[model samples]
Target: MAKIGINIATGSLQQEEMIVGIDLGTTNSLVAIIHPESKKPVALKEHNSSSLVPSIIHFGEDGAVSVGETARNYLVNDPANTIFSAKRLMGKSYDDIRKNASFFTYKVIDDNSDSLVKVQVGDKFYSPIELSAFILKELKTRAEHILKTPVSKAVITVPAYFNDAQRQATRDAGKLAGLDVLRIINEPTAASLAYGLGIHKEDEKTIAVYDLGGGTFDISILRISNGIFEVMSTNGDTYLGGDDFDHAIVMKWIREHGIDATQVEQDKMLLQQLRLKAEEAKRHLGQKDVFIDHVGKYQLQITTSEFEKLIDPLVKKTLEASERALKDAGLTTADIDDVVMVGGSTRVNLVKKEVARFFGKPLHASLNPDEVVALGAAVQAEILAGNNKDFLLLDITPLSLGIETMGGLMDVLIPRNSKIPTRIARQYTTQKDGQSGIKISVYQGERDLVKDNRKLAAFNLTGIPSMPAGLPKVELTFLINADGILVVKAKELRSGVEQAIEVKPQYGLTDEEVESMLMESIVHAKEDIAIRSLVEAQTEASQMIDTTVAFINKNREYLEEAEIAATTNAIDQLNQSIATGTKDEIQARIEALNELSRPYAERVMDLAIAKAMKGKKI
Candidate 1:
C-alpha cells in the first residue's frame, strides 16, 4: 500500500507546496499568495471581510493569547497586557528608546544596558521578538485557513531604512512562528514590484517610494535594471507618521476646549479615547469637509482646511526627506521616472497634492496602499518558488557569516541572503592588556551567540607588540568568490602579523541535508535565542563583578565603609542572580549595582582631577 498525503481541512492532495508573502506591519499585518488558477497575487481573506489584521496582541488572565481585532479591544480596558507598535521596538535597547519611553502604555524595563529591550506585563517579561511572533503566527494561521493548505514558507517585507539587527529580529520572529522565512525584502522594493516596475528585462527606470505608515515615514530612491531593484538612498523619521497627524488634532481640540492638559495626561483611558476620536476625524475628513463629535462636556469640530493646515508641517517634513534622499543618491527629481505612494495615510488629499507638487508628476497608487507590499511579497515568493520564469532571481548566500567576538557574541560580517561574491572587512580589538595572540573562529547561522551556530573554520594570528587593551587593531576580511568559496583573512595592523583560511561554504552538502539543517535551526529558534540572552547576561554580570571588586580594592581609602559594604552586597546579589535567574532578573541586579557605585566613581574621579590641578599652574 502507498501513503498519500492529504490536507485535512480541504480534502485536497497536498502535493504542491505554497509559499506566502507577508506584510508584518506596525499598525496592521496581512498575508498574500499567487493564485494558481488566475496567476495573480491576491491577499487571503475570509468571506466579505477586509484583508487587514490589526497587529496587536493581548494576554489574558488565563494566559491565553489573542491577536488582531480580538486583541485590539483590550487597548483601553487592559492596556498593560496589550502590545502594539512592536516593530518600533525591534532590535532596540533601553538607551535607544529612552527619550520616547512614554509613548508606550505598557512597562518597558530600563536596565540601562545595551542588550535588547523587554516589556513587562504583570510578572511576565516579553521581548519584541516574542511579541512579533504572535502577530506572524496569526497571519500564518489565517493564510492556512483561507488557502486550506499548510503554509510554512514566506517572504516578509521591512522598511528600507531598517538596520541589520532589526531585519534579523524579523527573521527570528518568523522562525518562532513556524515559518521558514525565504527572504527579507525592502518594503519600498516590494511596493515597486507590485506596480510592475521591474518585471521586464529591458525596463530601465528610476523610481521613488514615499511610504507614510501608522508609526513611521520613509522615502527611498531606487534604480531598476534587468529585473533587479537596488535602493540608492533612504531617509525618514522613524518616530513620525500618521499617528502624529491624529496627535495634532488632539492638541488643537485641547486648546479650543480649554481642557486641563494635566488631567488628560494623568488619565490613560481618557487619553486613548481622545486619540481614537482624532483618528476617526482624520479618516472622516478624507471624504467629508467637516467632522463633529462630543465626548463628556467637550464638543469637538474639525474642518478639512483646519486638518490640512495642522498636518502641513509633517507633509513638508516628508518633502524635505525626499530632497535629502535625492541628494544622497546623486539624482535630481528629473531623473525619477515614477513616484509611488504607499501606506493608508497617503490617501489624504493634501498629502497626494503635496507629493505630486514635489515630484512634478502624478502618483502611482492604483492598488490599495495597505495591501501593495503584501502583493509584491507574493510576487517575489512566486519567483522564489520557480513558478514565474519571466523574472531573473539572483543567487544569495544561504547563511550569515561572522566571527566570534568578546563575550562569545557573533558579530555578523555578512548577513544571510546578501548578494553573492561580496567582500566586507571589520576591525576588532584585544580584550586583555598585553594580549599577543587572537583566535579567529568563523561561524554560520542566524543566532546572536556563536555557540548556537555551526563552526566553519578557525585560525590564530599571533605576535602583537605589548600594548594596553583595545590598542591593537585586528582587521578581519571575508571574501566570498563567485563559486561560493569563502576566504577569511586576519591581520594585526600594528605588528603586520597575518593569517588566512579558505573554506568551501557549500562543499559536500546535498540539497536534502541543507533543508534538514534549515528546518532544525527554525525548530530550535526560540530556545537558541533564550540561551543566547542568558549567556550574554551571565557574561555581563561576571565582567561587572570583576570590575567592582578591583575598584573597591584599589580605592578603599577614598570610599566610606557603608558605601563599600553596599556596593559589595549589590555585587553579591548580582552574582547569585547570574547563577540561576532569568536574563531580566540578572540585568536588574546589575543595574542595582551600577546605581550604587556610580556616585562614588564620579567622586573619586573628581578628587583625582582636583589634586592634579592643585599641583599644576595655568
Candidate 2:
C-alpha cells in the first residue's frame, strides 16, 4: 500500500523520504545511507575518491572556505588559517584549553575568563560550531552530488562521553549545514548498530566498542536489550591514537639517523612530510611485513615487529582504558558479548591482536573500521524515518525545544526528532546577588543563540526569597504531550514558588520558514557569531563594572584618594568600551580594570581579615 522511492545513483531506499547518516569524527568524517534494494548500510563515495573526508578546514586569502583533503594540504603551509581538531573545542571554555593551547596551530582567543573558546582568523572570529558546519556542509554537498537529490536530514554520531552542550553544538552544526539533524547518537551505539549488534528485537548483548582514531582513542561499554542500546561507560586518552604511533616512528628515525631535533622543529614542511611518511609506513606495515620509504632523502624503514614493539605500550594504554571502562560499567571482559573494533587505527594487526587478547576473544571488524560509525548512523536514520519496524516513534517533534539562559544562549532540553510525550527538566540559579525572580523563555529552532531562534513562550516564577546569586535552586520543566502541546513549568524549590504555561510550540512557522531560518543561519553564521562574542564580552564587562562600583562604594574609607580616582577611571573606561568597542577591546579593558583594582581589593580584604583576627582567641 506504500510506494517506495530509491535513489537512482546510490540506491538509498526511501520510506516516504530519505535520510542519511553521518560520522562527524575528530580526525575525519564521512556520510552513509541505507542501500535501496539490499537495505544495507554503505558509505557513499565518488568514483576514485576515498569515502573518508579529512576533518580539516582552510580559509583562503580571498575569504573562501575549503574542507577535506584540499584543506588538509594547507595545515602546514597556512597553519594560521587552517583549523583542525575542532571537536576538542566544542562546548569548552578558554580555561579548559589554555594548558594545551599550543597543540593548535591557529590562534585560539583566550580571554582568560571562562568564555567559549573561539578562533581568530584574519580579524574575524569563528566558533567551533561554524568550523564544524563547514565540514558538514561539504559532506552534504558531496552526498547531494552523488544521490542527485537534495539531502536535508541526517543522524550524526558523537563520542559516548560528549555532554549535553557538545551534543547540542553538533546539532547546531548540522542545522548550519542545512541538515535537519535527526538525532545525535553516541559513537559506540552507532558502532554496535553497524555491526548489527542490536538490530533484532530479541537481541540482548553487552558490547564493548574500542575506537582508536587518528588523534584520540575511546573505549565504550554498552548494554543492549530488546533493541535498546545504552552506553554504560566510556574511557580513553584524548591524546593517544594513530598520531602517537606515527610520532613514535618519527622519533625512531630521528634517533637512528642522528637528525637534529631543532632542525626538524624549525622546518614545518619537513616535519609534516616526515609525519605523513610515518603515517604511510604505519599503514603499509598493516599489509606487509615491512615498510620502506623516504622522507626528504632520509631512508625510513620499519619491520612489522619493530613497529609493533614501538607501539606496544600505546596499545596497552588502550587496554588499560578498556579495563577502566569495564570497571566503571560494573562488568568484566567475560560479560562482554561482543567487542566491536572501530577507527582506522584498529586496522593495524597489532592493535587488533592486543585488543582481542585483552578481551579474551576475537574482534568484530569485518566492516571497514573508518566507515563503520557512518554505516551505523545510516541504520539509525532508517529507524528514525520509520523505515524499520524494530523501532518506531510515529509522532515526533520537528524542531528542538529549549530555553534561553544568560548570555542569550539556548539550552536544548528536548532535541529535534525526539519522540512525543516527552518530559524533561533541568536546574538553574540566579546570576546576581539578592535576585528574587527568574524568567524562563522557551524557543524552538536549531540556532545556538536564542536571538536566532523563534520564541515559543515565556513565563516568570517570582516570590523567591531574596538570596545571594546561585543560592536559589530553580527547576524548569518542559512536557510535550502526545497531542503536540507544550507545557512549560518553573519552580523555585526553596521558596516553593511555581508557574506554568501551555502553548502550541509549533504554531508560528511553516515548513518553508523553518528551512529559510536554517539557510539564513548558515548565510549569516559569521555575523551572528561575531555579534554573540561581542555581546558576551559586553555582558562580562558590564558585570565587572557593577561589581567594581559596589566594592568602591562599600570600601571608600579603606581606599586612598589616588586609589579611588584610579578605580573610577578604570570603571569609566570599561563602560565606554562596553558602549562602543569590539569584543577584543572590551576584553582588554576588563583585564586592565582587574589589574588596576587587584592591589586595592587585596589590601581591603587584608584589613578586614586583620580587624577580624585583631582580638580573636589563639
Candidate 3:
C-alpha cells in the first residue's frame, strides 16, 4: 500500500490523472512524471535503459517510420533518409534555413517560398511539426509502457528564446501526437523548478540558468517573485554546444593521426565512427586523465587537459553570451543570487569550473543535468493539474483562439491556457493582384478545421492599394484583455489601412463543453491532421497556379512561344495533380512547374532590375 499522488509534506492529494512533463529538445527528448510512491519527479524509462531518446527520425524503404535511437542508428549509413535537429527547423521557412540546410543529412524540400520548411524522404514529405510529432509519439508510448497507464496530457518546455511561431509549432506537434498540451513553459523556468528554486511565494531572487545542450547553448536570467518566474533576458549561440566539444576532440585526433579530411568526408560511415569515438573520448576524459581508443585504424587519444584546451574557446563563447545576457538584463555577477546549471554539457569539469569562477557562486548541479528540464516539466505539470496549490493563475482562455487560413483550416493565434491581457500579431498577404479587401474570421476551438470550431467574429478591411499578389503585408493583431474581451485588429502595414473589432471571447461555454471539445480534438487528432495536410497542399497549389498565370500574363512579350507552351503545359499538370493527387504528388508537380518557369522568371527579373538601374551609379 502506497500513498500515491499525495504531497506527503503538505498533506494534500495530487491529481489522479497523470500529466507528464516533456522536454522536447534539439538533440534528445525525454518524458518525466511524479513518481507516486516517492512523491518526487523522475524521468520514466524501462528497466536498465537510459532515459534519453535521440531526436531523430528515419523512414524505411517501405515508408515505415522509426524514431529516437532506432532512427539515430541510420544517420550515418542512410544519411539521406534520416532526419535530425528538427527542433531547429520548427516554424522555419525555406528562406530562413536555406543557408544552413547542408547541416542536416536528409533532403529538405526546396519550395523556395515563405511557407514552413519540409523534409523529404523518398516520395514522402514531412513538416518539422510532423517530424517532431513522431518523436513525441515515441516518448508518449515509452511513458505509457513504463507507467502502465494512458498518458494523454503533458506540459512541454522550449528554450526561452523560442518565438511565437516556434511555440505554436510545438503545440501543433503535441496535438498531432494526440496529447492535450497543458502548458508550454520555458526550459530555464523548468530547470529552476527542478531545483525547487521558485515554488514558494516568498522566494524572490534573480538566478541565471545556463543550458548547453548537444547543438545549442542558452543563458537566461530570471527574476522570481510570488511563485512567478520572468525571464529578463536570454542570449546564446544556437550552433555551439556539446557536439562541438566532441568535434574538438575529433579534430585533435585527426591532426595527430594525419587523417585526410577529404577521405573522411567521402565516407559517411568512417566519419560517423570518428565522431562516435570522439564522443566516447570526451566522456572518458571527463572521469579519467586520458582517453585511448581506435576508430577504423585511426588511433584516438586525448588527455583531459588537451580536451579542455580544445573546447576552451567554445566554453568561453558561452560565457561571453552569459555576459551579454546579464548586460541585456541590466544585471551584474553580484546581482545573480544563484547560478543554475543545465544541459549535459555542464557535466564537463572545465565547463563547471569556468562557470563557477565567472559567477562567483557554487553552481546548482545536485540534480541530474540531463533530466533536470524534464523533471521540472513534471513539476509544472503537477502545478497545472491543480495538484500543487503553491500558485494561482489569472483568467485564461479555455479554448484556442484562431483565424481561418487558406484551406478552411484554423490557424491558431492564441493557444488555450494562455494568460489573458496578451497580444499576438501575425503577418499575412494578398492571394491575388489588386485584392483590395481581406476578410478576418476568428474562431474558438481545439479542432484543426474551422468548420468544427465556434465562430467568434468576422470582419473585412478594405481599401488596400492595388498591388501584385504577395506584395502587400497585412498584419493581424489579437489583443485579449483581462476581462476576456478580445480586440481583433487587421492592419495593412504598407498601405496604413487598419480595422478593429471588439468581441466578448467567452460566449458562456460551460466547463463540460470545453472538456468535450478538448477530448474530441485528441480523439480525432490523426484524421484532422491528415485533412489539414491535404487542404493545405491544395491551397498552395492553387496559389502557385494563380501566381504563375499572373507572371505569364505580365511577361508574355518577353517570352518565346515554346516557353509559353511549356509553361502552360506545366500549369495544367499541376492543376490536374491538385485535383487528384495526394499531398506528395501535388508537391512534386509544384516543384516541376517551378523548375520549368524559374529560368525565364529570373531572366525577366534581371531585365527589370537592369532597366530600373539604367544610367544609375552605384
Candidate 4:
C-alpha cells in the first residue's frame, strides 16, 4: 500500500483548544504545540525524532520529494533542484532579486511570470509561495505526527520589515499549506515573548531584540508590563542578513587569495562550492581565531582578524539600524532593560562583542537564539487559545501606510509605530476642473518620493457629482486591523455615497495570477519530485551499502556470500537508476536495495544489543 501523510486541516478549531505557534524563519522553521494544561510550548518532533526543521525543499525527478534536513543535504550538490533561503524573495519582484543576485546559490531567473521573480530549478519554475508552502507543509506534518491530532490554529512569524505584500504572501502560503494562520507575528515580537513570557510587572520596561537571521535583519524596541507587549518601534533592512556577512567574507577570500569570483557565475558548480566554503569560514571564525581551506580551485587561509575587518562595515550597518530603531522608539540605550540577541547569527563572537560595545551591556542570549521566536509564538498561541489569560500582544505596523499625492509625494495616513486596530481619516478634494473621479494611489514606506516606496494599492473615489473645482469633499480613512492588513474606504462627504476602495498592490499576486501560478506549480510538481527522488534514492542506496559493509564484518559467519553479492548488486543497480533520473526505475531499485539490506540491518541491531548485554555482565 502506498502510504499517505495526513495533514492538519485549516481553520479555527474548537474554542479554548490549544493553538500552535510557528517560527517560519529564513534559515530554519519550527512548529510548537502549546500545552493547554501547563501553558508550556513543546517543539514538535519529526517522524525520526528531530526538531527544528531546516527550511529547505528539494525537488526530485520522480513524483517524490523531501524537505527539511534531508533536503538541506542536497543544497550544495543540487543547487538547481533545491531551493534555500527563499524567504527573502517572498513578495519581491524580479528587479529586487536582480539587485542581490550574487548572494544566492540558486539561479534567479527572469521568466514570463509577470515581473515576479521565478526560481528556475533545472527546467521548471517555482514561485516563492509554492517553495515556502513545501516548507510549511513539512512543519505541519511533523506537528500532526507528533501530537497524534490535527493542529489547525497557528500564529506564524515574519520579519518586522516585511511589507504589506510580503505579509499577505506569507498568509497565502500558510493557507496553501492547509493551516489556519491566526496571526502573523513579527519576528522581534516573538523573540520578546520568548524572553518575557512569565514576567509581569506593574511598571513597564523597554526591551530590544536584535534579530539578524539568515536572510533578513530586524531591530525592534518593545515595551512590556503586566503581560502586555507593545512594539514601540522597529527598523531593518529587509534584504540584509547573515548571508550578506558571508558574502563579505567570500569577497575578502577572493582578494586575499588573488582569485576572482566575478566570473565564477558562469560556472554554477564552482560558485556553489565557493559559497559553501565562504559559509564554513564564517562559521569557523565564530569559534576559532583562524580559518584554513581549499574550496575547489581556490585555496585560502584567513585569520579571524582579517575576516572581522572585512565584515566590520556590514556590522556597522546593523549598528546604524539599531540606532535608528532606538531613535524611532524615542528611547536611549539606558532605557532598555535588556538587549536580547535572537537568530543563529548572534553566535558570531564578533557580533556579540560589537553589540555589547554599542549597548554598554553584554547582550543576553539565555534562550536558544534559534528557537526563541518559535517558543514565543507558542506563547502567543497559548494566549490565543485562552490558556494564557494574562498575555496580550500589541504589534505595530513597521512602515507608514500612506498614499501617493500630487507630484509623487507620499501622503502618509497612518504613520509607522501606530497601534494596531487603529484608523486614520483624510480628506481628498477634486484634482482639476469638473473632475468626475478622484484617483487615489496608496503607498507604504518611509520614503519621501512615492516612486521610491512600495505601491500598495490604488482605487478611485467615484460618483463624485461633477462639481466645479474645489467643490467636492471626499473623506478617506485607512483602518489597520490587529492582523496589520490595511482596509481603505472612501465616502463622498456631501453626497453621503460611500464605496470601499479596492487597491491592487504593485508587486502582489492578483486573483488571476495566483490561479495561474497554482496551476503551473501543480503541473511542474511531479517533474521536480522525480528529479529529487532520483538523487535521494541514490543517496539512500549509498548509505545502505556502507551499512551493509559494516554489517557483513560482524555477521560474516552467519551470512552467505551470495547474500552479500545480491546486496551489492542491488545497490549498484539503484545507483545506476538514480543517474538516469527515471522515477519508476529508481523506486523499483530502491525497494529491492532496501529489501536486500534488511537482514544486515537486523544483524547490526543484534550485535549492538549483544555488546550492551556484555557491558551489563561486566
Highest TM-score model number: 3
* Order of models, best TM-score first: 3, 1, 2, 4
Would you list the clashing residue pairs of candidate 1?
A: none
Q: List candidate 3 stretches off by more than 4 Å.
A: 1-15, 505-507, 609-618
What is the RMSD of candidate 4?
A: 22.9
Which RMSD values do the candidates have, in order?
A: 3.3, 4.6, 3.1, 22.9
Candidate 3 displacement at residue 23 in angstroms: 0.5
- Model 2: how far is 143 from its true place, Å? 1.4
- What are the models' TM-scores? 0.90, 0.84, 0.95, 0.60
Best by lDDT: 3
Candidate number that wins on lDDT, 1 or 2: 1
The total number of steric clashes, by the backbone 3 Å criterion, in model 3 comes to 0
What TM-score, to 2 decimals, does candidate 3 have?
A: 0.95
In model 2, the Cα lDDT at residue 425 comes to 82
The per-model lDDT (C-alpha) reads 0.87, 0.87, 0.90, 0.72
TM-score for candidate 4: 0.60
**Candidate 2 local lDDT, 1-618, one digit each (tens):** 867667676565644566999999899999999987789998999998899999999999998999999999898889999999999999889898888899999988765566678787876677798899999999999998988777988999999998877887898788777777878899999999998888887888999999999999999999988777878999999988999999999999999999899999998888888998999999889889988888768998999999999999999999999999999999889999999999999999999888899999988999999999999999999988778887634477877789997789777898977777788887888889888788889998766689889888888888889997768999888899989999999999888899999987586678898768766665665566567668777877887787788889999998899988887898888899989988877777877787888888889999999999998988
How many clashes (backbone N, Cα, C below 3 Å) per candidate? 0, 1, 0, 11
Q: What is the lDDT of residue 136 in candidate 4?
A: 88
